[model samples]
Target: MSSFSSLFTRRKNKNRGRTSEKEIYDQEGIPKHYDRKLDRNLCSIQELFKQTTDYEEIHIKVGDLKGCVCYLGTTLNKSELNMQVLEPLREAFKQPETDAHRDLDYLREAFFPAVSYEYAETLHQLVWQMLNGYAVVMIDEHSKALALNIGGTDKRSISEPSTQTIIRGPKEGFIEDINTNIGLIRKKIKSPRLVFEDFRVGSDSNTKLSIGYMKGIVNEDILSEVKLRINKINASGILDTGNVEEFITDETFTFFPLIYNSERPDSISGNILEGKIAILLDGSPFVLIVPSVFTDFFQSTEDYYQPFFMTSFIRIIRYVSFMITLTFPSLYVAITTYHHELMPTPLLINIQSQREGVPFPAVIEILMMELTFEVLREAGVRMPRAVGQTLSIVGALVIGQAAVEAGLVSNVLVVIVAFSAIASFVSPIYNFSIAARLIRFILIIMAASLGLYGILLSLIVMVIHLVSLRTFGIPYLTPVAPFKLKDQSDVFVRVPIWGDRYRPSYLMTKAPVKNKDSSRPSSPDQNTGGKKEND
Candidate 1:
């Protein structure tokens, strides 16, 4: 901690002297709105989208209004578009009253009263609408084109989350469809204060995304920072939430995932309720939760569902496992190579016997096993589910046994490596486990070089790196580093539901109190005497 003071001070001072982008770019702008020419609009649509097989347009003449209904054929509901929209418009246009009113407003009021639509004023917007499954209603000489919400984009049914599964919790998970994901969240947290601001990211892809949060509960500063970062992104295309996450994260070089993401809608809703913001993107199941701290990754949404004691115990195990996964291999290398006196005589003898015929050093043995396990893990993930799980388990056991019999690795080292792999999986978030994996190699290298001292130094440096990082200006360590007593209830250990009444203080949330604090509840008979005396 004392070693990096001057470096920290210099970095902090450097950061303070930096100028904000807001001062440079004084104003923001939007895309160019096209002129109100029907033929030109149709020509532009044709020139831009005609190359695609899904591009579709139908010329519509309603009295004097000569316009076209354009949309992607792949996403359009042909039956509904014709029967509900086109038929009504054609019949309404044939009416005598249609001759008097040649306006889109009248056209809308008379025919589109039952449908949802958007006015596309630019070719970009029109293209976007069509791509997203809207049928644009363009007038002959009107710049504003009404886009009907008749998009029939195929979406998969919501299924159980592949990861983050709990023994007891909601089975429904988010799907690729953004609207459905939002609906799943809305189902959990039905509140007017739940506001979502939509943005179109990726200049070429124009990917639809929304940042959702409780209006008054969320910290406005962090919300603003989120918006500012997202608005600043100039990526050509974003295929997944991971892409957007990279662009908006506070730190670029950090191994830890600064943002927490999940496929479970309940988890996202739970985060939002606690004053954290959720970034939902179209065409992606994973929703990114912002203002994430280090502890956030260690936790599972399942913690809230179970009894507090059990949950607390599980959390403690996770924390312990996290430490073990990070340092056990390094410790083995450090102890066996340099500090042989530290190991028990019997255990040392057993290990020595196991390593008698092994060709590689302790560090090499650990690295070989780790790499083999990683290969198996990757292969299992890439392969089909049925084969993947079987392959990972059987392959690890078979290979470990084979290597042991072949005098390649010590039996004890195999156990350590296997246990380490298992511990890494205990983390609820996949990327969080990855951080430990990456850091383990660094620790191993250090341990091999300088034994226990190197291991300690490596750990201290890792801690410093974690503490130095921030998530939307919130310290990565949060309550742990600063030490917030109230927030601690739910950090390392979760207390009874009523006992922990406050949200995490580090968020600087507008609504800090989760609910009005109440006394711990008891059975009716147990509280009867107290109630009688009070009455």
Candidate 2:
């Protein structure tokens, strides 16, 4: 594979004419901010883009001067470009007496009806503008170019979120376009304090990423930390928020994702309101939320939408499932292989009966089943959608049953692995679920080696690792590790919205108390003295 830097350099230097070959780019390979002679500028740009098939350029006469419009054909909106930008300018310059050199500002002020346009003075800015689906107008003898936002709306329509689906909540999810994702958040939060700061990463791709936070609600220190880490990213290409997440994450060796990502817009909006910062990357539907804690992965948007008590109960079930997924196989291995007395009398007999005639020991049997289930899970994900469900069902039933009947593995081990797999699915974040899956294997090996003692040791190490991890300066096991009593209302069990009015104490938001009203609502009789409406 070609390095992005070399590929970009080759493209930039492909078709240059030997005229005035001064070094245009600085040490960092960014074009210098100086106005080249018009002919030289045009020639340099064309040479930079030479052999590019999708680039479209239009040369037009402007009184005594020459000018041209350039844009990428694949991304630019043709109809909007012509009707909004081209036609008006063409008509304005049609008058024979119009002087292009002097009337440039007049044309800009009087003629162009574009919704938004910006001036780019250097090749650096102009190239970035054109790459972002803007039409660049270069005029002769002019030091600057006009970049018109003449529509780049080619994107997937807003649809129900596929990844983080909820039974009752807003069905809207983020699309690939960064602007649309930001607009979704703005629609939810109509406050003027909502801020989106843009940053460009990737020297070759120049992928646009935006950090969004409520000006008053977000923690300034955390926001600054996030920006500092993002600005420190030096890469050739960033294709998705995952790329940015990896670059800015606090911990890389750990299995747990330091940054949380979600496809649902409502979830992101809720997090923003709670003083969390969101990072939106272009060309990816998933948006990342920072300062993510352990509980954030277990909590869902539906938790807020449903009754608090029921959601709380479900949240407890998720925590239980998390425990089961992580340790069920390990416990089974430890107990059956080393400490058989830990099992009850009947259960031990049943497990021993099932293991009779099994070809491998308990640990080997469990590993075989776990690895087979993992393969099935991966196949279910990668296979074509038409057969994915069928594949999962058949693999679980047919393959597992065959292995048990063949005495390759015990039926009890199969049940343990299958139950563990189901429990792993309870996590809302797929990345978090993957962490559980990974730790499950390590735990199985430890249990096999040192039995329950090894399992306990691994658990202690995991706790230490979790406590040591931080997401943008916030504790990974927050609200639980540091023991922030005020923030517990929404951590393990979410309290009623009225009962919990303050944002998380960790963020240290400017306005900590979002709701200063009474925690309890007054009954109708208490407010009205039991009087009828007619009275």
TM per model? 0.90, 0.91
Candidate 1 residue 328 C-alpha distance from true site, Å: 1.0
Model 1, residue 124: what's the lDDT?
A: 63
Give the lowest summed-lDDT range of ten residues in model 2.
1-10
Identify the runs in model 1 with alpha carbons over 4 angstroms from their true place.
1-37, 64-66, 93-97, 121-125, 139-144, 526-535
Tens-place lDDT per residue, model 2, 1-535, is 1221121112222332211112223333545553535676777677777889988888876666777888888778899988887887687567665454355566676667545888887787777677778898877778788888878957799999887867898888999999899999999999999999988777666788899999977777677667777777778799999899888888799998888899998899999998899999999999999888888899998898888999899999999999999999999989998998888999999989988899788888888888988999899999999999799989899999999889898887888899999999999889899999999999999999999999999999999999998776667898899899988899878888888889988777878997788477655665557775667
**Which numbered prediction scores highest in TM-score against the true structure?**
2
Q: What are the runs in model 2 whose C-alpha is more than 4 Å off?
A: 1-38, 99-101, 526-535
Best by lDDT: 1
What's the CA error at residue 427 for candidate 2, in Å? 0.7
lDDT of 2: 0.83
lDDT of 1 by residue, 1-535 (tens): 1221222221222222212222211222323456688887777677766579988788887776787888887887888889877898788667775454567787888788888877766666676677778888887777688889965856799899987776899998999989899999999999999999988777667688899999999987777667777777677788899999998888889889999999999899999999999999999999999989999988888899999999999999999999999999999999999999998999999999999999899999999999999999999999999899999999999999999999999999999998998999899999999999999999999999999999999999999999999887777898888787778888888898888788888776778888775668866555566465456
